[model samples]
Target: MNGFAATLASQLTSALPATAPLIKAALRADPGLLNNCVSLTRQLERLVYEPFQAIMKGDLLKETISKGPFDIVIDGLDECEDKQGVEEFIDHLLDFFQEHPRIPLRIFIASQVEQHICERLEDDRVQLCNLDSHSPYDDIKKFLQVSFCTAAKRDRVIRAYIQEHGEWPMKPDMDMLTEQTGGSFLLASTIFKYTIQPATAEDPTTPMDRLPFALRMNGR
Candidate 1:
């Protein structure tokens, strides 16, 4: 309906604002023409995709956007009103690239694991990847280090302490923090937050005091 058409049209306009008039002309010729999901996809291909690709073939690519490829992030697929529409859109998208799969574009769909959605994506053509498959130890360590640096800048005490001492997190401290994370980014963030929390009179513990205790932490 209007949802899919509007969404696609917005993206198209964002990518190529010069085509807004053409899009409006097409809509004016046929009112609510893209109300159907299939029509929306087809018209989008005609009005947006084909023309864009055609322009890209010539020297016009430089006048438009970056020649480099980019990913389209489509989130909340499970929230679509028309479940059937979702299936058809996916089918059409995959079929569109059946012959030429090297198009400089990607679609990243973020959706809750619903039966219908899962069934549609479960195909040889689609490459499915999950966050659980990736090891986030290095990323988590980098985030922790950056977060501490930011916090230290805001707090004078921390800045003074760091200036007097070297880096707040030495090799041993970083190692303990990384080990305590146990490969869970959420746990790592939570521990970092707890460590950096303002020290009260009742429980006056600085990040330095709390960070070392991570070495003694137990239970995964």
Candidate 2:
């Protein structure tokens, strides 16, 4: 998450060199932007904090407003290299919100449970959800069906298989694979990728046989 923030800051600073001073001033002034720097700062802030805030505030209506709230969606925080920067970034963010209690900014972060990030984000305003707890089987099945259907439309053999079989490994097959996946979207996607690999003369398309292999690969 910190890495993302740094990248964002670096990009914004590179694009608008005057943004840093402006943002600092804006933080001092009101909950919104004042100058061009403030404007850029708000833009940076929006990039990191707006989407979740919009959802939380239920402000889905897209209307032109003089000033808007900040929301952010951050994923893969644990993968970020600079731990100290991430901590400082989060601290400043929390401090900003602490100073301005009514600022309509929210942040949604998705990451594997890492101690430093989790500990900092354990504040009352933060809402934590473990991705492992979410059932991704249905999501994976739908995704696979869509991808396969799209691919089959382009590939003659896949299309012929679907036509001859009356259904291309239909819903039940998808469900079984989903169950086998144990709710890991990554695992399911890897399985799908392996299953769809082009068959050679020696190895005909036996996706069922390949499923076990995919699962084993995932276990590693």
Candidate 3:
């Protein structure tokens, strides 16, 4: 992702002057520099403006409404290769929103807060969510249950185990697994997959016992 961002930034630095007018014509609703060339304009348009427009307008069925009022979500902003470009993008975006106070479009971005990006977006209208503050245990547990249930139905071993064990993952096991995960969805998922795999089997009477050991082994 970082490499892609860098490559994109390099391309933008070379092509921005020629492409700025085209971009402005394409995003007429967006309020920013129509003449000023910038490296991140294209990336910002695709990741930010386009998604914002889509969300505000709802689906692509343009026949229903001429315009839409909606919010957009952008994740992994820091992954972009161009640091200065990212800053400029945020600056123009904030400026646009400031100019058009009621465009019915909101943007949500998730990333490791960088200084330039943070400075540009720190406004009264913007809402910041700290992912570290959330309790992800319940969410991870729910995701694991749903994912495993789907996988179990297809895999003969898992399906047979569930039948023999009277449901492989009961409420109690879920609680334990959730606690062990410490609210990391990736950790929980990796552990769950390993536990259910045939190679990890130990001929145990219950699948519940394997969960704790598997999670521990995976450093969950």
Candidate 4:
């Protein structure tokens, strides 16, 4: 959590350079507060929340609000190894928003529906969206198209196949591959890499040969 807090502080500094002075002032108030020894909540208060609050309440409030409503994206929170830390971090996050409801900031966390995360973030303050309800077929199709095009440019095997075979993976192949992924971004990316990765001595199959194989794997 402290590592996450430090990264957030760095990103905040980069995104809003004008707030650096205030953030630095907060850090100065408590020396070594950015270090790992400090609690995540304390690092957040001194480095992020306090500076953010100061800016929102300061003389330049109108100017900031004019540019208003910033977002902080926290992705793959469920992948964190420390379960207790994750729970504590979520608690701290919700408490911050609850205490300062007027702050013009929004945190968007994208993670699988793990019980610990869901239990904390199911608050009225947070709006939830289930990605499974929405089909990602079109997005996956576009990704495969762009990925194949880019690979064809850099990969001699794909280039040769495209030159000989007209489009390496035609509309029918694309539709099949897209369907095989079943709206999964991970599967889409995995198969893309599997298809285009350079062949080795042990696995000397060319990318031209791998497309059919990838399609065969389906969602496995």
Candidate 5:
């Protein structure tokens, strides 16, 4: 199995203890499948698909699904370095769903739009939603507020500034910063770190000085 698949399998096995015995059973049936030289397809079949089938046969899949929905969340598919492995994984995943139409498993994948991923997931079974359509301003603002509050307790510079100036990055300043970030968590995180980073010998700037500079740099 590839790194991504290996990680996914590990997480699934850890999360679902019942899979352990099924995996052990498969490995006992064919010890060679555990070898590193084994093909990804064979490894997946033995380790993942077979165990899932076992669970289904044991009626655990039905019992679990009867309670409610079961979702497997995979975050940042585009970030994985192995593009071919990702494609292969997606192919196998779609094939699994197609083969087992009765399986009530929902795979929630969060990824940036890439041609390979887009092409593979453009199937009728997949429901794609653009996350950018959702407003992230409130979430960003909360993150920034919590971050600054925590920093104020830790950073001596910020503490000193707060003592002298009532409150650093007052509500209006925070509102402006949140607006400037334009609902992008990445931008909000970058600006937060840039503004509150500790003073360095090469770039000696306190959070007090940098906060306003950050606001100006991002066109307040």
Candidate 6:
């Protein structure tokens, strides 16, 4: 991020524009730095990666970079079309940070678990956690509770029903519906959807008509 792009060689070219000035300034200050470099790759290394790393080091020393030791979030890696490119990115990224341990940058990747990705990331440096292992029962229950309370504020039919019946869904009904959701957020969401929907003249199924039925329909 100092100046080099996220990818190694592929991103090196785009970083040239930003790093060019810094490279020029350094070269002017000391002309003999890359004067002996015969290889194009070495010349490019001088122009981009070296300058970028130097800038990073300078910034780190000065504490000028905001979000020091910042997190780099890579969401939806599994959805990426270029599988090999993703692999290379993970490899180079981990190596770069590992090589520069003092550099304050934390990378966090969130993706649908893929075997190849899992295999590459299974290292002592990487703490691989299974996010889906935890039960979502409490979360789902809380979601339903909050959703029902919010829906009660909006729906006239539900409001009227609550006023007449004390609560649209009694404690037993709430428990039944929450239990029926079975820790599935999708099912919990649909239960709330059906519980708040307005009655149409054609269907004539008001939220009040749907709330009690959701427990029965969704099943315990």
What TM-score would each prediction reach against the true structure? 0.62, 0.58, 0.62, 0.68, 0.62, 0.55
Please report the candidate that would top lDDT against the real structure. 4
Which of 3 and 4 is the better model by lDDT? Answer: 4
lDDT of 4 by residue, 1-220 (tens): 6577778888988987767998778778777887777788787877888877766766566766788778999999999977888898888988998898878898989999899899988889889999888889999999999999999999888888788879878999999999999788899999999998999999999987888899897773
Per-residue lDDT tens digits for candidate 1, residues 1-220, read 3457567767877876765776776678767656653465676575655544544544555533455664668889898877777887787777766755766567789888888889988988888888676887889789888988898998777788889997887877877787788887788878878778888998898777887676566426
Candidate 4, RMSD to the unseen true structure: 4.4
Q: Is candidate 3 or candidate 5 better by lDDT?
A: 5
Q: lDDT tens digits, residues 109-176, model 2? A: 88888889988999986777877777776788888788777867876877777778777666666667
Q: Which stretches of candidate 5 lie over 4 Å from their true place?
A: 13-29, 34-39, 49-71, 75-87, 98-105, 111-116, 132-139, 149-169, 182-184, 199-209
Would you list the clashing residue pairs of candidate 1? none
Looking at candidate 4, the ten consecutive residues that score lowest on lDDT are: 55-64
Model 5, TM vs. native:
0.62
Clashes of each: 0, 8, 4, 0, 0, 1
RMSD of 6: 9.6
List the pairs of residues colliding in candidate 4: none
Off by over 4 Å in 6: 1-76, 92-108, 160-171
| Native-to-model Cα distance after best TM-score fit, residue 171 in candidate 3, in Å | 0.8
Off by over 4 Å in 4: 17-25, 35-37, 52-69, 78-88, 98-104, 112-116, 152-168, 199-209
Query: TM-score order of candidates, best first?
Result: 4, 5, 3, 1, 2, 6
* Candidate 2: stretches off by over 4 Å: 1-6, 9-72, 96-106, 201-220
TM-score between candidate 4 and the true structure: 0.68
Selected candidate, larger TM-score, 4 vs 5 = 4
**Worst 10-residue lDDT window, candidate 1:** 55-64
What lDDT is obtained when candidate 4 is compared to the true structure? 0.85
The positional error of residue 81 in candidate 6, measured at the CA in angstroms, is 3.0
Question: How far is 154's C-alpha from truth in model 2 (Å)?
Answer: 2.6
* Model 5 residue 205 lDDT score: 81
Candidate 4 local lDDT, residue 164: 85
